[model samples]
Target: MANLGLLIIRLVVGLTFVGHGAQKLFGWFGGTGVTKTGEWLESIGIKPGGTIWAICAGLFELVGGLLFSAGVLTPIGAALITIIMIDAIVSVHGRNGYWLTNNGFEYNFVLIAVVIGVALIGPGDYVLFYRP
Candidate 1:
């Protein structure tokens, strides 16, 4: 039951990130693709946001989400999620206060906490791979 809960959490969060990454990288899922994503990043003051940053972020989200969902190298996956979410908080949400309605860091913070908690708790017994 506990493992089932972990699996559900991992799948939901990880797949959502994967979709977001696809949006940024390939324009799938209604995303504007790399060029537009880069433009948005640049607008947010992330330099070289046109392509390089977009690719980097997309890879981070895509690969990290994959690893997280698969329960492989869970620490690395959690670290990636943490880094990206922190960037989001610093780059965009920090100024909006704590409510999502205000475009704040609340959602990012919850994600960070969830990933960190899962990492600490171990990916559980239902993982695709177990690192002994």
Candidate 2:
């Protein structure tokens, strides 16, 4: 039952991340694609060029989400997710306060916490791939 719970969480969170990445990478799902994503990244101070960062971030989220959902290299996926969320918080959300309604860090924080929890808890039994 716990494993079932874990699977559900991973699927929801992971797939959501995939969609987010697609939005950034390919402009799918109503996203602005690389150009706009890059501009936004620059607007938020990501630095060194928004296009590069956008691609990097998009790849990280897309691949990380896929790995996370498949339960393959779960820790790595969690780490990737964690890094990006932390970046989002510091670069964009931290100054907005805690409540998401204010465009704050709340969402990013939750994502960080959830991925950390998933990392500590193991990917559970329904995984398509397992490291140990």
Candidate 3:
């Protein structure tokens, strides 16, 4: 039952992150794709051009989400996701206060917490392979 619960969490969170990646990578699901996403990153002071940042972030979200959902290399995936969430907080949401309504870091913080929790808890019995 606990593994079942973990499976559910992994699927939902991982797929959601994948969707976010799609938005940045291919502009799917109402995403703006690389051009606009990059511009937004620059607007927010991420620097080094929007395209580069968008590519890196898109890859991170896509691959990390995949590994996370598959329960393979869970910690590595969590680390990738965690780093992006931290960047989201620092580069964007940190200034909005504490609520989504204000575009704040609450959601980012929750994601950070969730990924970190998964990193600590392990991917459980449903994983494709276990690390230890």
Candidate 4:
């Protein structure tokens, strides 16, 4: 039962993040793809070239989320997402402070913690990728 919950949570969150990444990286959801998004980030004075960082972030969120959801490479996927969230919290959210209501890092911080938890404890047995 606990495993089922974990698996469900992982899948939902993973797919959600993956969709967001797809929007940013591939313009699937009308998002400005990596190039434009990167340019925007550069315009805002973030580290690393806009395109590079955008690509890295997009891939991390997309690939990591998908893998985590699928129960494949669970550790690697969660770890990557955890690192990305940490980076976001420190670089982006931290600047806004830790208040979710105030559009701060609180939300991301919690998510990072969650990712770490998922990484440390693999997803539960309820999975679509397996039949056993």
Name the best candidate (by TM-score): 1
Q: Give the Å error, residue 12, model 4.
A: 1.4
Model 1: pairs clashing at backbone N, Cα or C within 3 Å: none
lDDT score of model 1? 0.90
Comparing 3 with 4 on lDDT, the higher-scoring candidate is: 3
**Pairs clashing in candidate 4?**
none
RMSD of 3: 1.6
* TM-scores, all models, native as reference: 0.95, 0.93, 0.92, 0.89
Q: What ordering of candidates by TM-score runs from best to worst? A: 1, 2, 3, 4
Q: Model 4's lDDT to the true fold?
A: 0.82
Better of 2 and 3 by lDDT: 2
Candidate 3 positional error at 81, Å: 0.6
Better of 1 and 3 by TM-score: 1
For model 3, the stretches where C-alpha displacement exceeds 4 angstroms are: 130-132
Candidate 3 C-alpha error for residue 82, in Å: 0.6
Off by over 4 Å in 1: 130-132
TM-score for predicted model 1 compared with the true structure: 0.95
lDDT by residue for model 2 over 39-81, one digit each (tens)?
A: 9988877776999999989988998899888888888999999
Candidate 2 ranges beyond 4 A from true positions: 130-132
